[model samples]
Target: MPELPEVEVVRRGLDAHVTGRTITAVEVLNLRAVRRHEPGPADFAGRLAGRSVVAASRRGKYLWLELDGAEAIIAHLGMSGQMLVQPEGVADEKHLRVRVRFADGGPELRFVDQRTFGGLALADMVEAAGAAVPAPVAHIARDPMDPAFDPDAAVTALRRKRTGVKRALLDQTLVSGVGNIYADESLWRTKLHWARPTEKLTRAQAGELLSAATEVMTEALAAGGTSFDALYVNVNGQSGYFERSLAVYGQEGKPCRRCGAEIRRDPFMNRSSYSCPRCQPMPRNPHV
Candidate 1:
């Protein structure tokens, strides 16, 4: 799952290479991955053939390419999907799932996915751009990175939740773009255990945790988003190096860099959460 930083990097790369280029043709190897006009794949290829890419942008993890006319190309890279600008060659036929060729012939924009979980949709560009798809996710408490972020607001959001802090962080509606890596890093920074209930924190403590969460995410984005599984890559096919700089994530059984306490992992939902036991002490459950 490419998070905010990964998606932002891909969006920037595509904006530089694909914007302003007029589409010469459309090729779809997997129809299930695309949603075309008229609700089928028939007019899809012809409708976008001569249109120019007016702009490119990203909201959350989805990427949008604005066309000169009313149409827009929307893509969700899911988990294993990757977009790259590569020269025309026979090798691309194997991995390339979709391509939008341009009139300039400079390079082909290809969507490649080993898992084939990614998807695409074509619709009114404005509708797609303005889709009721919940911008900035309402439940995300408050983004610590936002200049307007309010710690008081974050404390208020968490003051009543019964779920574990880590689980709360994973809730997209609660805080968009924060996944396992950032949640772990943020909890570790605040010295708050993942298993602790959100309501257990005092307002001051909750504010500290929120601030720490934002700091970790902002720094990670600056480092270009973590990439250890090769699933998250830029439009240019470059992997992020933030994984090399991670403090607790994927460092189980290793000594905590801060306190020398052994790093540990705990199962949460369908995935695992990592942390430093000494740094993030598990608090006792409150009286019912």
Candidate 2:
């Protein structure tokens, strides 16, 4: 899934290319991927025409296209979705879901998703993605990138939970913008075990962990986010370089970067969690 950095990158790219341009047309190749408005192809196209994108912004992974009135077009990339700005004559990719042509001769904004789990919606509901708890974005407890974010706030949020540090960090409502990759990397950087329970952590430990998370995520954003699978790409269609900088996210069974012990991958729900046993040892006394 595209996290905050990737979503921010996409929003910035689209803002430069599509903002202020009038929507001349909308082509929906897959109707099932759309929601809230336009039950079919014709209706979808009809609803998008003549509207201009007054501005573009992102809250977590959801991208917002502000139009006239209180209406806005909302999009979520899910796992495999990406927004691309292609030249006028460029051929559309096979995964194209929808394309918007602008009246200002700017490049077309295309939504492409290989898994087709992504969706689009038209709504006057202006709630940011993080406002809804448990839907990925809302799970984040705190984000260091936020100007108002304090390391102490992050510690306080985790202090109330008994969940494992990894699990708590993965909760989007606790912090916005962090995904699996960054979570593992941040935990590793702090030399904290994934199995460490939140309630067991001291305030100083929690502060250190939060600071590491922020630093790791900021570094990833600067590098354009990690691209392990074919899922993530910049708006310009270039790959993110952060994957090479990963210390523990996907290096299971390999030697730890900080310690000689082999990295481990523990199964967690649908996905797996990676860490270095030597660097992130399980707490000697497990939380009872």
Most TM-score-accurate candidate: 2
The residue-by-residue lDDT of candidate 1 on 102-122, one tens digit each, is 899889999887777776667
- Stretch of 10 with least lDDT, candidate 2: 131-140
lDDT of 2 at 207: 86
lDDT of each: 0.74, 0.77
* lDDT tens digits by residue: candidate 2, 1-288: 577777777888878877898998988888767854545667767888999888886665667787876667787887888888997789879898898898887788899999887877776643454342222233334456766666777678877777888787777667667778888888898899877888888999888887887787678789887785768887888777888888988898889978778999988757988989888887876442
lDDT of candidate model 2 versus the reference: 0.77
* Cα error of candidate 2 at position 90, Å: 2.3
Which residue runs of candidate 2 sit more than 4 Å off their true CA positions? 36-44, 125-142, 284-288
Return the top candidate by lDDT: 2
What does candidate 1 score in Cα RMSD to the true structure? 3.8
lDDT of 2 at 222: 92
